[model samples]
Target: MNFRELHQDGCFLLPNAWDVGSARVLEAAGFPALATTSAGIAFSLGRADHDYGGGRVDRDTMIQRIGEIVAGVGVPVSADLEDGYADVAATISMAVEAGVAGGNIEDFTGDRARPLYDLSEATDRMVAAKEAAGGSPFFLVGRTDVLLVGGTLDEAVRRANAYLAAGADCAFVPGAADAATIGTLVRELDGPLNVVMGLTGGDLSLDDLRKLGVRRVTVGGSIARALYRHLVDAARELAEHGTFTYADDQIPQSDLNALFDPKTH
Candidate 1:
């Protein structure tokens, strides 16, 4: 099935799963699809990475990792492909062949909080990515960082619509996506809506997001960060005070084992 169709089926949450274990748990919990969070993967690798900004991975690495997630769960995976991780058309061409059901290409730089390209250049990049994909009809999501870079929702909506016009199958406005803003974008733009869930927290439930016209919702790195925070706090508490408060609130061991059972796959 094509990504547009996957997006059109009402509100679907693509909970970000860091590794095989997390992916398996999400699959067992019955998520319709799971997308990889770049932040989560970076942390797993012990690499100082932020999506594609910190360091670019070889095509083999991306393919192997993405394919692993796709194989681990019987569901679609939309990779968090940061700007296709390259500036050249040839590099982006290779990225489109990575076997993800879809991906989001955000115009973010490593240290800068703003888009790396001018509006026109960003549009051209998205167009190039679409052509490189060879009409397999994958979701070429164009993400606007207006909110992230201290810009307005109206600006984000405009950028999103422009991205849609430039051939993105869906437009994603990460950071500070509110119901009113999301609803406004839905009414203003005429394609699929992809919003990031769980910044501080998802202000709306999946059903609520759908009502605001969001088709796809992703939780970004919150899952990985939450897990990290627990681990760090637990370690600190034990190192200093001898306690396991974080461990007490953890998921049961049986559930974890059950989710990763070989037979499940």
Candidate 2:
């Protein structure tokens, strides 16, 4: 199914892949669609996610990476275009040109001093993004990081509804995981609700979120974080204890090769 159809009914897990290998792995594992994680990509590039000090990957590199993932997998790929690379219209155009099924445009500014854009400006960006997509078969996700920045639920709901009116296919509130808040947003908002999983305090299970009427659930960077946790543990073991037990449960190289091989697929 296409990316837009995935959000039409019921809640489905959209796993985020940081690279071509991970994207292919997730597709081989039978995920209907995949999303490009900004944090995951940053971590892979040896930088922090949302680095406003020019530490994160460059815009062209990110666009190329998203395009690579889209080419590597048959599943629909949605990019997590951070703040639409600070240019709403241009970023949306770039994403569509890259052949992605859809992408997210967030309202959070990378600057810590003033983390979020004003509601009016944020809505305007969403409008511009929709205009940029035009008649393309693309899903535009309007994301508000209010709760992540310690804003009230009322404010998040208001921004979500505004973004929907501005032509977002889905309203993504990243830090809303509680049942009450999820239900409230579901009831109040006039569009499909997208919630992030595995964040601090937003750990609702799939059944719980589905019951609350959430239409889309994304894990953000949690999968990458979990893999890095294992990496740290293995490195620590090898450095301190001089052991190689970490390789005991690794996937066989032939299995991975077959999975990645075009003939096998």
Candidate 3:
């Protein structure tokens, strides 16, 4: 199915990949689509995720990385454009130019003192994004960090509905992991619902979320963080214990090569 159709009915898992290699590996694993995680990309570039303190990777760099992933994969790829890189119009245009089929524009302002955009300003940004997409077949996901920034569920629903009315194809509430909140949003919102998985108190199963009427499920940066955790553990073991046991569960070279081989793919 096309990327847009993925949000029409049943829920599907949209895993975030940090680079072309990871994107290719995920596509080989049979996921229908992929997303570029801002955190993952930042970590790969030797920086912290959402580098609010400054020194974040620039927008052009992100667009280039996203384009590489699109070129490397056969399935649709969406991007996690952190605050639309601070310019809604340019970010949307660059994403489309980079061959992205979908992308999210969040309301987080990257300011610790004032974390989120006001509801009206946020809705206007979404409108600008939708207009920038023009006649292209782009799925513009309107995301609100309200809950993530400690706002109430009611406010989240309010902002989500506003964004949808402004022309968002989907509304993403990152911190609404519990079944009740997810269900409420699904019932109240007019468009497809996108939820991030593995939140502290909101770890519902895929079947559970689907039953709750969720349309899209993404892991955000959890997969990248988990993989990095394993990497750290393995490195610590080898460095501190002088053991090679970390290689025990590694994928064989042949299998990895087969996945990357163009003809095989």
Q: How large an RMSD does model 1 have?
A: 2.5
Report every candidate's CA lDDT.
0.76, 0.91, 0.91
Taking all chains together, the TM-score of candidate 3 against the true structure is 0.96
Q: Model 1 over residues 146-238: C-alpha lDDT tens digits?
A: 788788888887788888898888888887567777788888876888888777885588888878878788999899998888788888999
Q: How displaced is residue 55 in candidate 2, in Å? A: 0.7
Encode model 2's per-residue lDDT on 142-231: one tens digit a residue.
999999889999999999999999999999998887898899999999999999988763557899989999998888899899899999
TM-score, cand. 1 vs. native: 0.88
lDDT of candidate model 2 versus the reference: 0.91
Error (Å) of candidate 2 at residue 104 is 0.7
Q: Write candidate 3's Cα lDDT for 1-265 as tens digits.
A: 8999888899999999999899998898899999989999989998876736787888998999999999999999999988887789999999999999999999998887999989899999999999999999999999999998899999999999999999999999999888788889999998999999954535588899989999999988887888898899999998999998989999999998888888965
lDDT of 3 at 256: 87
Number of colliding residue pairs in each model: 0, 0, 0
Instruction: Flag the better candidate by TM-score, 1 or 3.
Output: 3
Give all TM-scores, in the order shown: 0.88, 0.96, 0.96
Model 3's alpha-carbon lDDT is: 0.91
